[model samples]
Each structure stands twice: as C-alpha cells, then as structure tokens.
Target: MAEKEWGRLPEPPREVVLRVKRYDPERGRTWWQEYRVPTYRGMTVLDALLWVKENADPSLSMRYSCRMGVCGSCGVVVNGVPRLACQTQIAAVASRENPVVTVEPLHNHPVVRDLVTDFTAFFEKHRRIIPHIVRRDMREVEEAEYEFLMTPDEHLSIYQYSLCIMCGLCYSACPVAASDPEYLGPQALAQAYRFIVDVRDEGYDRRIAIVDTEHGCHRCHFAATCSAVCPKDVDPAAAIQRLRRIVFLRRLGLWRKRKVAPLAGPLEKPLRRIRAEYPRHNLVEGADPERQAREPVDIDFREEWLRE
Candidate 1:
C-alpha cells in the first residue's frame, strides 16, 4: 500500500528537528532523541512523529487516532504545554531557521513509555463522578422508553460542555492535580457540571454528593490553565466555579435540584421525581464512636443534608 501524504504540499517540505523525550520501562531509563523530519506547510506534530516512526526509527512510540481532532488520542506536551498533536500545526511550534519541536508525555500522568501516559487514574476519577444520566425510573432507563424532549435554548445551555472528548489535557495542565493526587481534576468536575445542568438528566443530588467533597471540585484553585489548554475550547474552570456556587447554596439551604426535563409524550406529561440522596461520610468507616466524636472531621459543607 502507498503511504498517505501527511500535510498540504502548498510549499516544499523543509527539514525540521523533532526532539522527542523517550522512556523505556524495561530498562528504566529516560532520554531524548533528535531526528530531522521533513515538514510541509500544514504539517502537524503528529505528522512529524509518524514520519520519524516510519523512516528514522521503527521503535519510536506515540498514541494517535483519527488524524482529525475528534478522538482526543494524540494529546502530548508540545514544548511545555498540553496540546492535541493532530490539532497543532508544526509551523506554530517550529521554524525553518530554529527548527526544533520538543515532544513529551503529559504532566500529572504516569508515563507508560516514550510518549504514552497511563490514563487509568485519570479515567477512574472520571468514573467516580458517575458520568451518566440518573433518572428515578429504573424501568424507563433499562427498558425501551420515549425520548427526552429538550428545546433549543435548553440544549444550548449545556452544549459547550457536551463537546468534551475526555482528552485529559485539562487534567494534565491542572496545577491542583499536580499538587493533590486525590483531586477529582477539571475534566471530571466539568463533566459533573455538564450532567448536573443537562435538562435531560436527573442526577443532581447523587452527583453533588460525590463532587462536593474536599478532593472533588473544592480542590480546584481556579488556575484557569485547564480552560487555556483545552483543545475543544471547553471551559472547565468556569464549570468548577459554577459548581462551587451551587454546592455552597445547597449547603446553605438556598438551592435545590431542578425538576427533570420532560419526556416526549402525547398522552401524559413526565412526572416530577424525588431527588436521589446519598450520605456524605465524614468519619472513617469502622472508627470507634469515641474517636469519631473526639476527632474533628472538617468538612466545608454544613450538615444540612443530615437533617433530611
């Protein structure tokens, strides 16, 4: 099979140096390898990496899928910033005169090899937020059901967040994630807000209970880097801020979960369902009653949830 052309041939390709950070778990070693790669007018970082892997070194490793930006698989640190390699043009990071494109694995993630970072923990944090719609009628969810109707205005409200590809770029650029390993990170928190505000979703009480804790949305220090580095232009920092306000209001007994959006039906209107509640555990499980009483579990939210 013929090799596919990488980028536009508007201009002649130039020789650019690609300085890649390499790691070998088998040898437990880390090093840098520089390769001179041919670049074109619209050649991307991923294109250069492919060229290197095919021509210069077959052992060179990196992750990429769907040369387009949809899959979010080619996330890497391009000269100290988390970016989608497929979306980043080579001209943006390198020049013919000073031609050097430094590539490395994302920060705050465990490196698997050369440029691949382990997403096990990152995905685990995402799963803990319960990134799915929660409706009271388990039967409706499990069995066949009518579509949940939503207006254009309602759809537009949460449309931006729906664009998240779970690329982990926000999590990699998050300063809070760098400091606290337990922090839920921006991607998860943004996704939490996405489902919370989604008119079709009814998972507010259940999700809020999970993200209202210290290691959850509260850990975000509002660095805004997560928003800055997002390839899809999703503002996770803004979502975190809004989530914080909602959490505060819920604690102060000022806000309540809104009713679920209506289902498409000509016979009857969708019934309002009671919010699903989950307990917030402040004390360690199996701790002595005396120790639980003596120790101060400093939870920021009030015990208003306990009253219900």
Candidate 2:
C-alpha cells in the first residue's frame, strides 16, 4: 500500500489584493498602494510583503527582524485591526466583499517610511515605569546572595503579561495614546503590572506613584480596546484595573500586610510554603461554626474600610 498524507494544499488560483498604505517623508506624501500576490498555504502578511519586495517592488519598505513573532518589530494595522504582520495569514484576513486587506503603519506612532513607525515615544513610556526589579536591600539583590522564589500561582499571576512583545498594537488600538502622547499607554502599563505582581520584584513602592498618576492607570477608561487587539493575550485593561485596586486599597489601609519576600537557595523553604497570608477581613469572625452555620461573606472594600 502507498503512504498517504493527511492533508493537501488548495490549488493555486490563490491570489489576493494586498492594499498597503505608503508614505514618503521626503516628498511629504502618503497614499494607498496595491499589489496582487499569489498566495499559498501558510502564506502570512509578512510573507506576502516579502514576495512583493523581492519580486515586484524593491522600493517598498517595512521593519521585521524575526519572521516569527519574537522581536516585536513588524507591528501594523491590517484591515483597520492592529496586529503582527508575520502572525496574520492572508487567508485569515481575506473576504468576499473586501478581498483587499489593508496594511498600514501603527496609527498612533509617526510613520518612518512606508510600513515602519517610530518607536521613540513607545520606548519612553516603557522606561518611565522603571520596568525592573528593585529592592532596598541592595546587598541581597545586587550580590545575588539568594534568589527570590515564588509559588506556581504567584508566577502565573503575571505570566500572561510577560508574553507582551511590545509590538505596539495595543498602543495603536488605544484612543488614549493618539490623543495624549504623554499618557503611559497600555503596553507599558501591562509591563508595569508584570513586575508589580512578581515576588522577586520589590519595586512596587517605587513604581506606584508612576502608575497611580493622572497619565497612568487612572486614565484607562476600561474600554478594553487594548485588550481586544493585543496579539499576546496580555489583559492590559485588567492590569490597569488591578493597579487601581492596589492603590485604592493602600489608601484605605485594608491591604493585607505582606510577609517579607522569601529568598531561596541551597538552604531555604520550598517556594509554595513561602506565600504571604490573605487579609484577615476575608476570614469568618467565628472559628469552625456549627457544621452548617458558616456561610461565605461578600466583602466589599468600601464597606470593610468603614467598619470599626
């Protein structure tokens, strides 16, 4: 018997119109340019652009370092949706009435050439938050006497945020970034939360003021448009909301007192055993109430804070 393949590719009349937005800074002009490229199975938007650049238009330009979605460089607005060019397939964006999927530089950022946009403002916002682990005990942190250890649950808290490639899709999708250049956009805000939740990072006190400002988490209207368009499932809107909760809880003095962050090495407790305890307010007033007498309480911060 002959060996059989599980799948076969579609026959080649797979052609689509790639309408790209172009800009020439020197001539001070911008326009829509179209190209008809023969698509194949697994052909991405980046792949289509490469085929055009190699076969059709050498003048066309875009920035893409890793063809895979690692480097976070090839961010563009496709079909009015912000996404990673290399990750979006031609077949995915193609449709009957609008067979022509549009490609353009990120809307909020200044276009450098054709498909590339300037990241100066994007990176500056990232830097403003001081996105790094900071500890007052310089000796323990800098000398690496011991490593800060975290439970599996603790690590998972911010793991989704660490996946952000800083592709700027969220920033482009945000109406806030476009109108207020000084606003710390969703990408940086998400990153701020990534470290803020980490057991290893002690930078919360240092970073809180930066994110608690008028241009910070307070500015997010919870439209969640940033979360909707993020290629990486980093829920920036949720992060901002959590930041607000942290700040508000602190002001009310209801935040659970955290134990000193644990340090693990050859001689230390296991990570899971090192977790800080939950707030006392969450616990029932009576201990082990008669078999079925106890019921879970619905605790609200506003209500609890006013309680004596």
Clashes of each: 0, 0
Residues 175-264, candidate 2: write the lDDT tens digits.
Answer: 888788888999898888777777777778767778888898888888888998887788898988887788778668775426446777
Winning model by TM-score: 1
Off by over 4 Å in 2: 1-13, 268-308
The lDDT leader among the candidates is 1
Model 2 clash tally, residue pairs: 0
> 191-257, model 1: which lDDT tens digit per residue?
9998988887877888999999989988889999999998887899999999999888999999876
Q: Where is model 1 more than 4 Å wrong at Cα?
A: 1-13, 266-308
Give residue 276's error in model 2 in angstroms.
40
Candidate 1 residue 150 Cα shift, in angstroms, is 1.2
